[model samples]
Target: MAEGDGVVKSAGRVLGLLQVFAEHRRPMRVSEIAQAMGIPQSSTSMLLKTLTAMGYVSFDAEAKAFRPTLRVALLGAWLNEEFATEGSVDEMMVEMARATADAVILAVENGVWSEYIHVVQSEQDLRYALRPGTKRPLPATNLGRVLLAAKPDDEIERIVRRINAEAAAGDRRFDVATTLDAVHAIRRDGYSFAHNLISSGASVIALPMPVPPGYKPMAIGIGGPTDRLERGQEMILAEMRRLLSQYLGG
Candidate 1:
């Protein structure tokens, strides 16, 4: 869909507007977008019309709104197995959850964001309920911090600033120096853990997976109530390393 030499170049803008659609909870009206983002109503209408016709969005003629379609998830699914390594990370996640009785998540950096692509819930009825495709801010959780800390310093600062802009001013537990020190420690020690950063009773421990040559593998985290993970984080960390190594090779 490349434009001619001198025609126009709003395709990027159109795609960006569609991305905005993915993050929203409810279908948006042209006026709602115009007021919310300062974009013009006619432009929004045109973009919505194009998106609806392309099957990326569904138009509610009765409600007069445009909603995202299943196409996006289908597109993402087509690429998951391509990116994931062939291993027992899934099996290890389940075993870890059962043995530790803690919820476990398989996460990987997807471009600028980190996604929880798989989950194994703890057996207890009180355990946290997590699902596939859970996305969260990278700086707000230990899982994000572990991945962020592994990035280059300049990149890490840029991400930190972005997270700060979206975060409340008073919520000031993390800063560059302290976070960098934490990252250094994780890299040296080969695992990351945190308690009560995202939820009060929640604790998390993450370890990097050995990915294939020329491909970045991923990191998986075990999370549950601090009371349980605290009593067993060290043991879980040990077992995960041994099991992951068996599949990935030590």
Candidate 2:
């Protein structure tokens, strides 16, 4: 390979490796990382060695696992400060988790998908298990619906059509009219909620977060078992609104 091509490949692998760490949110063995990245173990080992030497990753002798070090986190710390107050989104998600005892997710639109960028796991015994980096169809998920609500109807229709076009045969297609109706309802009600839409016996309540111009739109959501979320919907919405108003000034 050309020297420039090699450099780009290595850089992509480095970022991909970090993404794996972010998604799992735990120490990972070399084999696990290789399997997750679909790369060779030797290549993964070399990357880990380089990162360890750079003080960006550390190896645990006892557990035989590797984890990103504080240095990796510090790399993006200033970006958080520049955008939203550092830890403000995290604090808001944590507070919502505490108030509802359910999973709280921060999501943004990525193409035609709603990607969960961060998640606070539920504390309740019976709850849905969600992780950061999970993606849901923009028209099919409550979080996605709130995000779609932020867009114009014409744009939403285009996205729904694109999603349908890309869907495999036998997969459910998003009905443009129904999706538009849902988006209208979300715009009117100022939030989105659904039961047993994505997962059986699960429900989610989501609201769009205000973003500065040029920033990607985001949605915050609380999810849990249908019965529990239904029972606490009012309280959860109140707490969500309160925290959003407090931390995000919306």
The per-model lDDT (C-alpha) reads 0.70, 0.86
lDDT of 1: 0.70
Model 1 CA deviation exceeding 4 Å by range: 1-87, 166-174, 214-217
The candidate scoring highest on TM-score is 2
- Compose the digit string of candidate 2's lDDT tens values, residues 1-250: 1124346878778987987886677999999999988889999999999999999999999999999999998887765564454356766778889998999988998889999888888878898888666788899999999999988999999999999999999987999999999999998999998678988999899988867678788999899998988898899999998888777677
Q: Write the per-residue lDDT of candidate 1 for residues 1-250, one digit (tens) a residue.
A: 1234443658645545554553344788778765544567888788778877889888787898777888855666634354434344555666777766778887777655677767777778778666555677665667777777668888877777776766676754448776777778888888888678777887788887666656644677888777877788779888777767665564
TM-score of each: 0.60, 0.83
Candidate with top lDDT is 2
> Pairs clashing in candidate 2?
none
| RMSD vs true structure, all candidates | 9.0, 4.2
